[model samples]
Target: MKADPRGVLTGTHFLDGDHACCEGALAAGARFAAGYPITPSTEVVERFASRVPKVGGTFIQMEDELAASITLQGAVWGGAKAFTVTSGPGFSLMMEHIGYAAMTETPCVFVDVQRGGPSTGLPTLPAQADMMQARWGSHGDYEIIALCPNSPQECFDLTIQAFNFSEEFRVPVMFMMDEVVGHMTEKVIIPPADQIEVVPRRHTRKAVEDYLPYGTNGDGVPEMAHAGEGYKFHVTGLTHDEHGYPNMTPATQDKLVRRLQNKIHDAIDRITLLEEECFDSEDVVVVSYGITSRVAQRAIEMARERGLKVGKLRLITCWPFPEKRIRELAATTKAFVVPELNLGQMVREVERAANGKARTFAVPHAGGSVHRPEDILKVIVEASR
Candidate 1:
């Protein structure tokens, strides 16, 4: 389905990552948003709240992060493409609801503009520390789609994809942006609504009495029923039967839990999105994401100048981590230099995937700022050797 032209700001404009994300959400048909404003990411909801009225949508400033997190789910069930935006502290508060969104199979989106922290650390600085939390912060066994946008341009582009993935998989998709990217300003090209292709909501066609909210078709994603539409579908945060009623049996638990994990695990090949450059003959590869990817490019160039054959693997989709591609590259590459704005979260995944097929090194940064190109180049040069 093409976007509604009314919501699309179809032209080029100089915009920050946060504003670009807001524009992207508007373009993707997000007509409702609920969020407790927080730093770096506040601009996202700020723009949304200001623009939603113009685009025929609603924006609610909930009391707190928890309310904002779950309220978006209510909006989704009410048949709106809805989401919330947050940063470090608020992201922490939203974890429980993230679990709830996963358990109930609620189709929603979470825009987390990351900052340095365990607790209110560096609210204004950039960091990618939440990468692991996006995958495992929510308790229990469940899977979600997470994307990292590297620039204001990608911030615009990937925000649409995040909504599309959430709708397609019937799960909350995380748009993991960082403070730098969220605040950085760049030229963003928003094409006409007709030029953009969007995935329409998979609304169930069955009658109210025939609907089975937990029942999935061949693709493992159950069709969603509109709330208050006479479908009378049930949604719960517990293990549920096909009818969406709580089912306490261990067997029921296994069935529901496994499906949640398998739906994403099975689609890893199709869901994993990454960009590789100069990998054909490079001996060392720098794997990074979000704002860090841009910083890594400088390191890649520096390594090249020093006679190091370096390539780059930028993770466009962070979760459903590109294990296969990493494993495949491990076989041919001499090593991988992972530079992250955190203390080596994703680098561990790289090491595991490499499985000693090739060595892996980390150029860890303790958040407040990004890595210096020469710092990453040092690691790249070491890995090259």
Candidate 2:
């Protein structure tokens, strides 16, 4: 379906990532949001709360991050495309509900404007440290889509993708932004409503009598019925049968859990997104994402001027990790230099994918800010040699 013309802010304007994300969500048909304001991410829901009423939606400022996180899920089951925004501490509070969203096959979006942290480390500064936490913070076994936006332009573009992926796969999609991207202002061009294609919810066509909440036609993703649809269905976080009834059996566990993981695992190629530059020919590839990708671009330019065969791989979708691409590059590139705001999280994924076929270097930062071009260039030079 095309976006609503009324909601589409069709024009070019200077905006920051958080505001851009809010615009993207509105443009993509997100009519509901529940959030607790925190650090850099606060602007997202702030904009949503102010703008949503005009567009026929609801925005709730929950008492806490925990309420905000799960309240969005309730909105989703009630038949609205919903999302929430938070920073490090709020994100941590939302972990349990993230797992709940996964277990119940709830389609929702979680925006984490990452700040340096274990608890409340540098609440107003940037960090990519949450990369691992986004994947593993929720516990149990499941996969979720995670996208990183380096610019306000991408921040707008990728939030739509995040919602689409969530609806299509019936899974939570993580919109991982950093404090730098969230606060940094840039030009954002929002296109006309007709130009934007949106994925509508795959609501079931089945009659209420025959509907099985957990029943799949063929694909792993089951059809959904809204709460008031009279579908007579059930959904729970425990292991369940096709009818969505809790069943304490190994057979149910194996089938349900395996299918949940396999839906994403099998579609990794389609879900994975990367922005590549000269990687096919360059002996050294500098891999980075989010704000760090922009920083790495400068290093790539500097290395090229120095007559080095350096390439750039900017991860647009960080989770689902682009292992195949990295593995293929491992056979060609001499080394992979990963620069991140964290000490080294995603660099480990690059290294694991590269295995022993190529050397991998981590250019880590404890976060609070971005990496300097020279620091990444230094790693690129070393990797090239």
| Best of the candidates, lDDT | 2
Report the C-alpha lDDT of model 1 over 1-385, residue by residue, as the tens digit: 8989998999999999999999999999999999999998999999999999987899999999999999999988889999999998999999999999999988889999999998899989999999999999989999999999999999999999999989888889999999999999999999999987777888998877787888888788899987788886788897898889998999999998999888888888878888989647679988999998988998888778877788889999999889898898998899989999988899999999999999999999999998888898888878887
C-alpha RMSD of each candidate structure in angstroms: 0.9, 0.9
Off by over 4 Å in 1: none
Pairs that collide in candidate 2 are none
Instruction: Write down the TM-score of every candidate.
Output: 0.98, 0.99
Model 1 residue 103 lDDT score: 94
TM-score quality measure for candidate 1: 0.98
What lDDT would each prediction earn against the true structure? 0.91, 0.92
Query: Model 2 has how many clashing residue pairs?
Result: 0
lDDT of 2 by residue, 117-208 (tens): 98989989999999998999998998889999998988899999999999989999999999999999999999999999888998999988
